[model samples]
Target: MPDEMALLVAEVFEAAGVLRRSGEAIAAADGQTQARWQLLSVVSEEPLTVARAARRLGIARQGVQRVANDLVREDLAVFRPNPDHRGSPLLALTPHGRRVLDKITRRATEVHRTLAADIPVDEIIRARALLHRLVERVNRHEGDGRIPPG
Candidate 1:
């Protein structure tokens, strides 16, 4: 039999793919892609520099910059002057962007509700806990896993 840990990792990747596709469809209704929607969501709370947003999203700064530029072009978001740093401005969503994000969020909530209809809340909680533990352990390893497992 395949190692359980390996199988769990595989399952996580599969789940991510499904979730990404579902998110893409939800975002598409508002003329947005998954990447754009994610960036918008991140900045919806407060403005952050492209570098900060990229770090938060665990994605490349250049990629976030591209998405931020596109959002600005679409009038969904704006780049405002940053008092903290003159060179790197913070990315903030426009009024239109807030409406778009709200719409997408509502749609996503509905879809998630339907998807979780059959699953017990406790089971879902347990699964989330397990995933969280796995994520913490993975982060502790950083990029290299050469350390001997204790």
Candidate 2:
């Protein structure tokens, strides 16, 4: 069981690396890095504070803050006052940001269409379900100092 788990972990890590590299390439055409693209995508749905965005992205708050700052500097996003939090402002996408994000989404659609052409929809659905289950299991054991040996 442990060996099976080890194998699964290795595969997941490799897959994540591949996805990140591919995502970087996809985002690059829009003049953005993977990190920036992720941040912008998150904020595009709704304005969020840096800490909130970090939590949503499963990353460090400080890192998200830096990216948020950069996006603001680039005129891609804007920081608006948060009514819920006085010190932490909400990050929202600017018009330029929305335009860029739209372009990226269009490109992503094309990429996904090409990639999914040969892949069966049922297999993709099952893969997503399995990943969700894995995430749930990991989250349930978070900070417990140990994971049960499957």
Candidate 3:
């Protein structure tokens, strides 16, 4: 069981790398990378502070902050004052950002349809369920300090 779990973990890492590269390709035409696209997508519905976005994305706050800064520089996003936290402002997409994101999303929808054309929906749902279960089990270890630091 342990060996099986280890193999699954390794496969997950490999899959993530492939997916990241694919995402970059998907967003490249829009002059955006996977990281920027993901960051924008997360905060599209509502503005979020850097920390909140980081938590939502399961990544470090500093990385998200850098991406946010880049987005702001490109005029794709803006920092608005947050009443909840004066120190950490909420990040929102500008009008230009929204337009770009919408275009990207439309393209992505078509790409996803093509990618899933050969795959059965039930299999995809099962795979997602398994990954979610894995995530839950791994997260439980964090509470008990079972995960070792790099």
Candidate 4:
């Protein structure tokens, strides 16, 4: 039998792969792109500094800056003066960005419904709770300088 930790690690990897693949499949259908989706998603919530969005997305500041520049050029997002930071600006989604995200959301919902038809609602709820607990535990352990065991 597989060890408990090994099974957990396998499940984690599988879950991550599923999410990535699902996102890719959805993006492919409409010729949508990941960077654009992520940029718009972040800006959809609230205006954020490029550096802040980079940190939130776990990407390099330079990469975020490049994406932000492209978004500005495409008129999908705009940079407004940041009162909180000296020279850095806040990124906001344009109406075009909002429409793109809305379409993506509807498509993603359809994808989810199709893929999740076989999954029990209670099982999904339980899995969500377990994943939240796992994240919390790992974060706590990492914060205290301990390596979280798989």
Candidate 5:
């Protein structure tokens, strides 16, 4: 049997693959607008400064700025002056953005329901809880400037 650490690593990789595949499937179903979808998805939840959004998305600030600009042009997102930051702006989803997110959420719910139907509901809930715990642990460790030992 694989060592505990090795097993954990493998599970992590597998989970990441599943997430990537699910994202691709969602994108395919919605059409070819990954940036727009991502932007809409984030802004729908809460307003985020461009820099913070870029950091959360793991993309460069310039790239996020471009995407935000496009979203503004399309009337999907609006840039509001950031009272906290001198020159930076916070991005908020427009009404159109909310509508798009509603549609996407419905489709995502359907996909998740179909995918989870074969698994026991309890198992799914447990898995989600575990994943959330893992994420929280990692974030806490990273925030303290410590790399989690492999």
Candidate 6:
């Protein structure tokens, strides 16, 4: 079982690298990096503090803050005073950011469509479910120490 798990982890890392590269290209179509693209998409649904956005993206808050600052400087997004939290402001996309994000999203959608043309939708859903289960298990006991040898 451990060997199988090790194999799965290897495959997952490889898949992640491939996806990140594709995502970077998609984002570059709108003059953005994948990290900035991710942040913009995350806040598109609703405003969120940088910390919250970082948590959602599973990255460091400091990295998100830097991206948010750059977006603010470029007028792509704006930081609004948070009513819930005085010190931490919420980040929301501006009109221009929305357009950029929309373009990137459309491009990504087309790319994904072409890539998944041969794969069955059911298989994709099953794969996603398995990944989610694995993530959940890892999150639950990630720091509990190494697994015992059988």
Q: What are the per-model C-alpha RMSD values against the true structure?
A: 2.9, 2.7, 1.8, 2.5, 2.8, 3.3
Off by over 4 Å in 1: 143-150
Per-residue alpha-carbon lDDT of candidate 2 for residues 1-150, written as tens digits (9 for 90 to 100): 379878888999998999889889999998899999999999998999999999999999999999999999999999999999899999999999999989988988898899899999999999999989999878778647477733
Poorest lDDT segment (10 consecutive residues) of candidate 3:
141-150
Candidate 5: clashing pairs of residues: none
User: Which wins on TM-score, candidate 4 or candidate 6?
Assistant: 6
Give candidate 1's error at residue 80 in angstroms. Answer: 1.0
TM-score of each: 0.93, 0.92, 0.91, 0.86, 0.79, 0.93
Q: How many pairs collide in each candidate, listed in order?
A: 0, 0, 0, 0, 0, 0
Query: Residue by residue across 101-136, what tens digits does model 3's lDDT show?
Result: 888888888988998999999999999999999888
Clashes of 6: 0
Model 2 regions lying over 4 Å from their true place: 143-150
lDDT of 1 by residue, 1-150 (tens): 779999888999999999999999999998899999999999999999999999999899999999999999999999999998999999999999999999999999999999999999999999999999987877777646754533
lDDT by residue (59-133, candidate 6, tens digit) is 999999999999999998999999999999999999999999999999999999999999999999999999999
Model 3, C-alpha of 111: deviation from truth (Å): 1.8
Better candidate by lDDT, 1 or 4: 1
Candidate 3 Cα misplacement greater than 4 A, ranges = none
lDDT (C-alpha, whole model) for all candidates: 0.94, 0.92, 0.92, 0.84, 0.81, 0.94
For TM-score, candidate 1 versus 4, the one ahead is 1
Candidate with better TM-score, 2 vs 3: 2
Which TM-score value belongs to model 5?
0.79
Can you list the residue pairs that collide in candidate 1? none
